[model samples]
Target: MSETQKLETQISDMRREKNARPFTLAIASGKGGTGKTTLATALAEAAGMGVTLRDCDVEEPNAHLFVQPHWSRHTEQNRPVPRIDAQRCSACGKCAELCQFNAIAVAGGRAMVFAELCHSCQGCRRICPEGAISDENMPMGSLDCGMQLKDPAAPINFISGKLAIGQVMAPPLIRAVKNVGAAEPLNILDCPPGTSCPMITAVRGSDFVILVTEPTPFGLNDLELAVETVRQLGLPFGVIINRADSGDSRVHDYCRTRGINIALEIPWKRSIAEAYSRGDSLCEKGAPAKPALPQLSATWPTTVSVPTAMLMPPICT
Candidate 1:
């Protein structure tokens, strides 16, 4: 057998032996630039426990910019992509006809397959009577996991994945990272921006979701979409208003009216941003916000409910 085949077998065996622990927390936002990563890393560090960080934002992963991890293992995340055998293909367009994703198309008496478009559903292979469709493992991305022993006195483990450029599917890589770090070590999943498939996959299995947002009009709009996404997934989540004082109070009002809890409000502060840009944990700097970290952590399990009405009047954008 080829080396790839051997590697595949080993990975399969490893997954079969894997048993994931619960209590995954997903940090997500309706959009980017909301300091989601900053809050995620801070919460993880301030939790001050053995936690595994999974940066699921494959499109533009930047968590490594802050919480650096010592190298442990980097493994390729691959998925089965269909390959058509020219000799066996009958040009009957059976494969193309069966593919719901439209990944396969026939023209000029031959069929072509688009790997990126394929969702690996295997419908084409199953429907093809000619047995012309074969599946091959295609490289998707890479997952890096390591221990964050930044201070010899303090130790933490982190796992992150970088999706290959042009790779549209990020859920697979996210799952790969999670699988590798499934020791149930207080997982903090820093999900990708947006309320789409990638975000859904990242937070689907989490125990709770921390929806990070700002106080601007755009922030409120995106926060609603994000809340809807998490609610549709039936996951309990709360809001963390980053840049709390930068914009209108619409986010607070909306959260209150919708019966969503505003778990934490990170005020708009230049020092906080500067510290983040410089790769320093706000909790480590003895920043004023540092003291509130413990309170935020303690509220996770008990404060699961949101208010049904707003006491303060809503502010116009």
Candidate 2:
């Protein structure tokens, strides 16, 4: 067998073994408007039954618009914020001093807790010498459990997290959404944009990652940042160039130089864009993009394999 064939066999076997447990695939982008959601929903549809799609983009999750799963359960998620006990007396400013985020402050012989500033680390509660610090559950967001209700036998389990209107942090809520869907054979996490904590939290535990990017200058710039991020994370990942024919060849060159595979190149199509605007899935029947999506899903492990050497090396600008 050739080197490529041998590698393909090895990866295929590895994926089969890993499928016995939950196999998570996270779809992420360095910036927004990179067709991250478009590819994510397409892949999820192509995976067919028993696949769980977790929309971890808590701030502005829109995957539901495409799948349109019938939501069956709604849950309110909460984070533990430090609540100071005035009766415990002796403020002594210990809790405030221990808080790195300045979520707690000692004023007027009392301590005030800023729920918005709290990261839910519980550091202040742990360090309070006077035992004046306690935990209060602050509402972080909501989680909705739904499925492709149209077909009960072949349901696509859909779960999404939505951050509260004023909530500044999203990693905690993203973590909550990820905690579920462990029992499914395949889980696709649609991560938030950028290389911040929220995106990191979403993609951290995935078995494989698919970074989506366009070929424009902004896309190339952020894709470089995202490539660096997944490299730092030590995760196996590949790039999918959306609108592959629209921009310059710099993105292609970057992948070539790094020995990174451009797993798939989706050329721009006006019909696909029009269908997407109407909340239609790429893999749905009569959809303009249906044909190309199956080729992606059918390739699977062979398509996603990244060279071990490529994943380890420092990315160049």
- In the range 170-238, model 2's lDDT, one tens digit per residue, is 988999999964468778889999998999999997877889999898998999999999989998888
Q: What is the C-alpha lDDT of each candidate?
A: 0.76, 0.82
Error of 2 at 267 (Å): 0.9
* TM-score of each candidate structure, all chains considered together: 0.83, 0.85
Sliding window of 10 residues with minimal summed lDDT for model 2: 308-317
Candidate 1 local lDDT, 52-98, one digit each (tens): 77888887888887888887788888977789888988889988888
Q: How many residue pairs clash in each candidate?
A: 1, 0
Candidate 1 lDDT score at position 83: 92
* Alpha carbon deviation, residue 34, candidate 1 (Å): 0.9
Worst 10 residues of 1 by lDDT: 308-317
